[model samples]
Target chain A: MPDFDFAQPTSLNEALELFAADGEVRALVGGTDIVDQLKTGRRNADMVVDLKRIPELQRLEIEADGLHIGAARSLTDIAEFPVVLSDYKGLADSSVLVGSWQIQNRAGIGGNVCNAAPSGDTIPALLSHETSAIVASSSGRREIALSDFFAGPGQTVLQKDEILVELVLPPIPDDSASSYLRFIPRNEMDIAVVGAGSFLHLGSDGAVQKARIALASVAPTPVRARAAEGVLEGNVLSDELIETAAVAAVEAATPISDVRGSAEYRRELVKVLTRRTLGISRDRIVG
Target chain B: MKHISITVNGDQHELLVEANWTLLETLRDHLRLTGTKEGCSNGNCGACTVMVNGRTANSCLVLAAEMDGNEITTIEGIASQGKLNPVQEAFIKDGALQCGFCTPGFIISATALLQRNPDPSEEEIRTRLAGNLCRCTGYDKIVMAVEDAAAMLRT
Candidate 1:
């Protein structure tokens, strides 16, 4: 790793100013992925603006709107937060599943989304909740839906001078629940071969009022299974309907053959995990 | 170069370090604390595990500059007044280590686990120590050692 200047900015404005002054700069939070990237020469920067010191980026608040998760909050903190665990179980599940316990103690949702890996665990879960990313730059702040934030693998719509500030999730409706599941070769400390996250709101009539499905490790970015979700909307969840939605999820995936799994295998896992996650989400609503 | 203050093993040190130097490098090269072994250095193996502010973390993944104003505990800090910590004693008594290369990291991780959860079930112990990899002893003795350590601490 090459030597670079390091700045710990206490405020978002100061961080933005530092970022604007430096042409080649990277924001360091947990440094779990980026440090490794730097060691491997995969990423290079002249300065690293540490955002962990920024108070606003480390706060976690639950408001009337929903939960406001500070971008720099550790995964462990988010996973164990009472509000998150009770109201956003899928996010909590994905938070704890990001890495090992030690990694979770440092890694946060911000770096996870910013790194923008196709197999990132938190992404599909965030997308399932319809979360929005609050990004800040010298120009000002803007909110981008989590689904629209990712441009590609290892890329996002965030400008070089911009930093992700927080993730805002809308108020979870009554009788609504979500689940995130992934097929990993190992139980822990391994990336997902295929991941699925499902969020569903069941109406009093026992039909699906709303449904959101997101799949990971199946495309260049975490993708929404819109067609699969379309199958669930306004319909009672039956095994046959779930099978159809699962098939649609398979069709939605555009996985490539990698060492972890073949494209076909990933597509198959997508169907299986999609079915399983939807089943879990439905059970949460009914049970 | 970056000047950072860190409390390691209860001793405070102010040092000038290169920005790219990891906490592992700072400990081994600068502070001369070679007990924290570097196995994978990519966060895959927890050979460089240390307690940063009472929580175990992979020091290899943390930049030295980030250690500023942080309290760190390494394997060297586990002993007290020339006495081996209970976890270390249990490891020795249970024959948990063979090569001893991964011993320090496992000790640090086990100490951390016991600190947080005094009475950890076998499965809980396994889950907590999942990050640390030991090539020798096949982990059975290591698990027994942590269990024994928990019991010993309770008594």
Candidate 2:
């Protein structure tokens, strides 16, 4: 790794100013991925603008509309946060599935999205919740829907000058519950082979009012199975509907054979995972 | 290059390093704290584990500049006047180490975990030590060593 400069800004404005000053500067948070990339020569940046001291990006606030999770907030913080666990159990559970306890203590959600891995565990969970990213730049600020955030594998729509400040999770609709399930080879500290998140809303008649099914590690990016979602819409969750939805999920996937698993295995796992997650979401209707 | 000051093992030293220089490199190369081994510079092997402000972290994942003014405790800091820390003593008593290349990191990570959660379950120890890999000893004696050290601390 070449010798470079480091700047730690104490305020968001200062961090933004430092970023705006250098076109080659990269924002550093958590450093879980970037530091390793730098050492291994996978990434090269002339300057690193450290954002750890910026207080605003570390806040987790719950508002009337939804939950606002700071981009710099660590995975352990998300996993253990009471509000997160109570209001967004799927997201909390997904947070704990990342890396290990040590990595979870330091891996930031913002860094996860910014790093933009196809198999990022939180992507499916965030997609199920209808989350949006709050991106800030010196020029202004804007919100980008999480669904539209990722451009491709290991890429996002974030401009080099803009910084992701927070993730705004929309309120789950009434009578709706969500669950995230991922299949991995090992129990701890392994990446997901196939991940699925199911969010289902049941009406008074026990028919599905709204539904969302998102999957990771099955496509170029985290993808919503709209065809599968349509199968559950306005229909009571039955074994038949679940089977159709699960098949549709397989049809929606574009997984490739990798070191983790074969494309055929992932397609089959997609069907199984979709059924399991939908069942979990449907069973939550009892209470 | 970045110039930063860090307090390690109760002593403060200022040094200049690259933005990419990890705390592991800063400790082993710059500060000459050779006790902190560099088995895998990546975070996986965790041979460079250290306590940053009382929290255990992969020193290789942390940039030296990010640790400015932070308190870091390495394997060199765990003892006083050449006496072994209780965890180190337990490691010897339990024959927890064979190659000994990973002992400093294991001891540091285990000590940090036990300090925070003194009465950890066997599963808890396994979970916390997941990042720290031990190729030798098969980890049975290491687990027993941590339990023994916990009991020693309790008494």
Give the Å error, residue A246, model 2. Answer: 2.1
Q: iRMS values in order, in angstroms?
A: 0.9, 1.4
- Say which candidate scores most in lDDT: 1
Best candidate (score: TM-score): 1
Clashing pairs in 2: none
* Clash statistics: count for each candidate: 0, 0
lDDT of 2 by residue, A164-244 (tens): 999998887667788898999976778889999988888989898898889999999989999999989998778999999
- The CAPRI category of model 1 is medium
RMSD of each: 1.1, 2.3
Q: For model 2, what is the C-alpha lDDT against the true structure?
A: 0.86
What is the DockQ of the complex in model 1? Answer: 0.79
True contacts kept of each: 0.69, 0.59
Predictions' DockQ, in order: 0.79, 0.61
Candidate 1 is scored at a TM of 0.98
